[model samples]
Target chain A: MWLDILDRGYRPGTKLLFALIRLLSGQPLPDAAKVVFYRPDFYGTRAKEFTHEAMRGPSAWSVGDRELMAAYVSQVNECAFCVGAHTATARQACHDASRVAAVLTDLDSAPIEEPLRATLRMLGRLTREGKAGAEDMRQVLAAGASPEQVKDALAVCAAFNVTNRLADAFGFERLTPQGYEAGARHLLKRGYR
Target chain B: MTGGHLPPVANKTEGIVPDEDDKQAAFRALADRVLNGEGQASARQRAGAFRNHGLAPPLAALIGKVADRPAQVTREDLAAARASGCTEDQLFELVICAAVGHSARLYEAGLSALAEATGEGSPGHVA
Candidate 1:
């Protein structure tokens, strides 16, 4: 990470907690998690709550779908760490590694429903341009997404749009594939809390 | 129709919708907490980060990078901002503000687009 504080400036309690986690897990915690723990009172508390709700709250989109959107947004922003972490999580949540891979590789040709494809398209445009037009929303709606689904998808987009930038700004260290899979397992079990 | 040259109703409601979902509400709260809530960075710095303008040279350049192109942000940017006499905590808060503000802009645009597409609001209100 870019900040030394984030790397080693955890409060004593947090440090002890991190040590226990490392002892049990046999690996250091991911930097993304570390960022949240570094300053929970400042902004991490709300950020964690918002991200958890966005990814796990009541919504039309499945957990896998939301994870896929997170990965896609991260990809658009060129945040490799987020892409790896979320792609693994998406694969685990959806139980279809090939499908996740296909979507990431070539979304247009990916084997997915039209509704999801349309939503991802809209999200991609918004992430890249930092704005989307009414016509874009119309396409998603016309693709069979209810208004609520659009709202849900935008929630995911908004969350990752914040996270991807944070990952890059803090320079989150990229984990190994195994590390990503482990983190993915934790996310599946814990749901970003 | 009776009022002379009244602004569009959509313009009056160009931001977050009144009835937001749980996720939307949470997202808004997160952004609000970072941009408007108490933190190490001054209110001026936080607002400047959100607006992507109006700050001293070091922080201004750093916020611009985080808001527009975070992938391009380097350790040097953080160092320079810190060198401007702001602590690491303040720099971190400003960076969070920039990222959250960028997302808030897109989030609002998205909600407005959905409103316009559904004919619930008018077009040409977004910048």
Candidate 2:
């Protein structure tokens, strides 16, 4: 389900940067990346800035935890492109990639701390149901998560909930395994901005 | 955690960025324009589109489908929107507006839940 928007140089500045990135990497930019480049001045810039702040900005949650939370939300939403890209990023940041994968496949049995698991369950509810109530937050807090960590984790979940819908609705180009790895590396190094 | 109370949802905006208030105001302004401002889509059409999560008639059906089941969106869906007279840019704007609305609701939900848990205020009447 991909939008038919032309994925080429449109804006002068974005076009130049895309060209340079393609030339250096020897690979085309992913549709997810190109989609935002469409209106860099409008919502695109804001979306990117907010994503950076949510995913890579300073927080009690580790980058890995945030990435994993994003991947988990994508998984629940069934956005394959985001699930692949963010899962790769999560794997890179976490001590154990398999654990992340396990959680994705089955959260109940995954080898994760209780607080993070509780938070992830909260995210799942948020994504599927569009709301997680006070009881959910209380459970997470009782599991030992700090309020700051819960807020940061929810921000990641909320940001991805937006991105996942955009990617799916627009029909983002699905990256290959190699492309996913490369994309993950780029995000890890440069961050969302 | 003694004396702890859930902070207001509006206050959490600061945690997202240093200038979150400005950013949020800008986003809300854009959203208002997109959803409520004049455009090619008629006022009725825009309201129905926002409510139904698509434009009108057959197109609204498709938009509703996409809103409900995003993964089911395909080239056919895009082509249908185009055939219904939606330009690429309009389609892009619609998607952003719908998504931003969804995100806002989620943020409010989390904040409300947290506020309730801390016994600070009721979910909707947070203060």
Q: What overall lDDT goes with each candidate model? A: 0.83, 0.72
Fnat per predicted structure, each in turn? 0.84, 0.52
Docking class of 2: acceptable
Q: For model 1, how does the per-residue alpha-carbon lDDT over A1-193 read when each residue is reduced to its tens digit?
A: 9988888888899999989988887778999999999778777888889899989988889999999999998998889999999999999999999998998899999999999999999999999887888799989999999998998888888889888888988989999888899899989899888
lDDT of 1: 0.83
Candidate 2: which stretches are off by over 4 Å? B1-54, B123-127
What TM-score, computed on C-alpha atoms, does each candidate reach? Answer: 0.92, 0.84
TM-score of 2: 0.84
Cα error, residue A116 of model 1, in Å, equals 0.5
TM-scores for chain A over all candidates: 0.98, 0.94
Clashes of each: 0, 2
User: Which pairs of residues have clashing backbones in candidate 2?
Assistant: A1-B74, B49-B54
Query: How much is the lDDT of residue A191 in candidate 1?
Result: 88
Residues A55-165, model 2: lDDT tens digits: 888787888988999999999989999999999999998967898889998999999999889999999998888778889999999998987677777778767877887
Can you tell me which runs of candidate 1 are displaced by over 4 Å?
B1-17, B122-127
